[model samples]
Target: MSAGASGVGGAISAHGLGGAKDLPIPSELAIAGAVAALVVSFTVLAVAWREPRYDAATSGRPAPAWLDRLVSSRALAVTARVLGMAFFLYVAAAAVFGQDSLINPFLGTFYVLLWVGIVPASLLLGPVFKAVSPARTISMAFAKVSGVPEGQGLYAYPARLGYWPAAAGLFAFVWLELVYPYSTDVGPVRLWCAAYLGIMFIGSALWGTTFLERADPFEVYSSLVAKLSIWGRRDGVLVLRSPLANLDTVVPRPGLVAVVGVLFGSTAFDSFRESTPWLQLVQSLSGSRVWPDTLALIAFSAGVALVLTIATMATGVTSDTPRRALPDLFAHSVVPIIVGYIVAHYLTYFVEYGQQTLIQLSDPFSRGDNYLGTADLQVDYWLSSHPTFLAVTKVLAVALGHVVGVVAAHDRAIKLLPPRHQLTGQLPLLAAMVCFTVGGLYLLFAA
Candidate 1:
């Protein structure tokens, strides 16, 4: 949604990723994709497995012995921690010493590398942030020095607060990204990083590392997406769960719906805010665009949560599972959709700016130092140049996500709803999912 070099800002501008974009898909193709999603929804309902298929304890097959051993080894763990700390320190140095210009690698690293890159990294590596998180490393050091048990704090983490903190943290991040006008400034972004580390450290110390799992925005987001990866565990043995099964294993926790809502909604809002109408409206206004944009962001997020809640609860539920609990319980179904949109929204930005970040990292102070041996590398714009392929890929990604979401919601419905109500109970949620998928396609087409 964001694009172009502007008068006031440089680098990845506040509104643009700065490159040629895929032409909008034809209206016919967009309609075809939406129809495909609906057709697949019913096809799954009519012929797919009726009994729930995933169980965290039994779903995946264990990996080979040697591979599992290497993966779970302490040596590998320590190496990952050291590498993580090294990367964090490298970026921290840039923030401390670099200029506030567009060339600063910190900007690309934050907005592109870390924020957008985490999705793919975690997908391949499984909870990658947890492996190398600086806050987590420091928290461990603190626990060891203070003689506290690992991952233990002053008290037990309350179960009632499940994921709420992470949801709030994620919102804060998207606000800073999408709403806060000074998002690209070095000082402001640096301060946000400092505050993030500070909060992560303090929270981990008080509540142990458990706090980070449910509160550190990056950790939570990465872990959520990791569920879609082929890597998983069965009874503490390394195993591979199919993405669908892995997705079904997600625990139904309080505030889970809000977390997914913020993720999907923020992305949709990014497209909306960049639309021509929004641009004209904001431009013609008399004041700062902050409040209008903030309200719009909030509305997008809350709107997703509202739709999910209402759709999931509209049908009759059993005595054991309240209608109110259905949203969070069914929330996992939306993860694939979120991941799909993430891929569509950030693919070009991540690949193009990612290369730029590598180039800039070699010259963190903007003084042309080739410290990382990557300063001489040039970015490949092949992906950006091939607009047709890129556009088609985006539509397919959205459609694939929609299909997975439909299957997930369907499985959960049949498993939870009474047999008589199973099919009927899924109709409302199916419609809601279709709307989301169509609207997302519309945004990409219109963007």
Candidate 2:
């Protein structure tokens, strides 16, 4: 978590949000982790499963009929939508009416739960946000009332647009959280959400739920991570597969590389901007930190995308596949790596601040009320207290994500590249993956 203004009716501080800073990960551990990532990456390239193993159309055995029926039931779908809408409205009321204070639940819901929590929730429950997305629910309701079929819109969604809208949405979010000075402020953040909801509603009206699938940042992100969960579907039947195999099922789409760039780069920028050197420089600029931070954010995001584009395209390609399409084809492999790094970056923050948020949620109005009986609960800071254990966990998570990513990319390479160039074509992507891991470790150490 990052620092901010301490109390109600005050603007956010530029330092960072949340409370209690993490001790910098030890230099030795950072090096060891980076070395391990490099070693495991090459090892996977050399000896891992070489044949193309995961196919969406044929992989994964059908799950139990009863379980599938329960999961796909109309009653269950309605229940999920109702619960999602109810929760959205509950926190939305807080955003609209509650005190502009750190104690407000709206801030927590937007920043921590919705933004950070979506990863783990989707990993565990498979596209959990999509199930409970209020945007989708409201759009469906409007369609029904207007006598239009649900998910049927005014026009066919443009395939070429792909995930670009989602990429933009993601950049907007990271900008708000990392670069925008008043991110913790109630009014600005609320306005952002209002605009998000408005755009989602209008887009869904124009392009149907396909717009949400392609444009909703949280949905796109959650769905990507869901590919790593054991849960899956084969011909609309619930099935289970190895997470790696499940991950291989992701279909390449335009702007996927951009999504990868923004997620990873913004996170790196988050750490970089908070480093002592950066803080001192920005503070001495004799101007607002907003411009510097915004520029840095753009640089980081663009840097990642550029590296990815060059790395992916700097390879042999068959005549059947355009060189330009290679980046999106390989973009799915970056999902696990991103998830792994995010866990390392935000683990303690989410666990600790998430608890704080829950306790605060019990008293959304800040009126000395404990409606949820959780107001008195205390956050356990054991993770923050044990710096070594936390550091090791972060390193392990990064390494594990790297290994999975390498294997995913390797499989895709075998499937997509010419037989003669399969091994050679993968070299650049593998190197890029190593740079991402090592650079992430360096940030964990230096920043």
Using TM-score as the measure, the top candidate is 1
Mind giving the per-residue lDDT tens digits that candidate 1 earns over 37-111?
Answer: 677677766576677776777888888999999999999999999999999999899988999866788877887
Task: Please give the RMSD to the true structure for each candidate, in Å.
Answer: 2.2, 2.7
Model-by-model lDDT, in order? 0.83, 0.83
The residue ranges of model 2 lying beyond 4 angstroms of the native Cα positions read 1-25
- Evaluated at residue 175, the lDDT of candidate 2 is 90
- Candidate 2: TM-score? 0.94
Candidate 2 lDDT by residue in tens digits, 1-447: 243322233322222222223445566666666667666766766676677888988889888889899999999999999999988988988888889878889988888788889989989999998999999999999999999988999999999999999999999999988777787789998999999999999999999999999999999999999999999998788998899889988888999999999998988887788778888999998578889988889999999999989998999989988999999998888898899888888787677777777888888788888978999998787886786677778788888888788888888888989988888888898888878887887776566
TM-score of candidate 1 on Cα atoms, chains taken together: 0.95
Error of 2 at 248 (Å): 1.2
Model 2 steric clash total: 4
lDDT of 2: 0.83
Model 1 misplaced regions, further than 4 Å: 1-21
Structural similarity to truth (TM-score) of each candidate: 0.95, 0.94
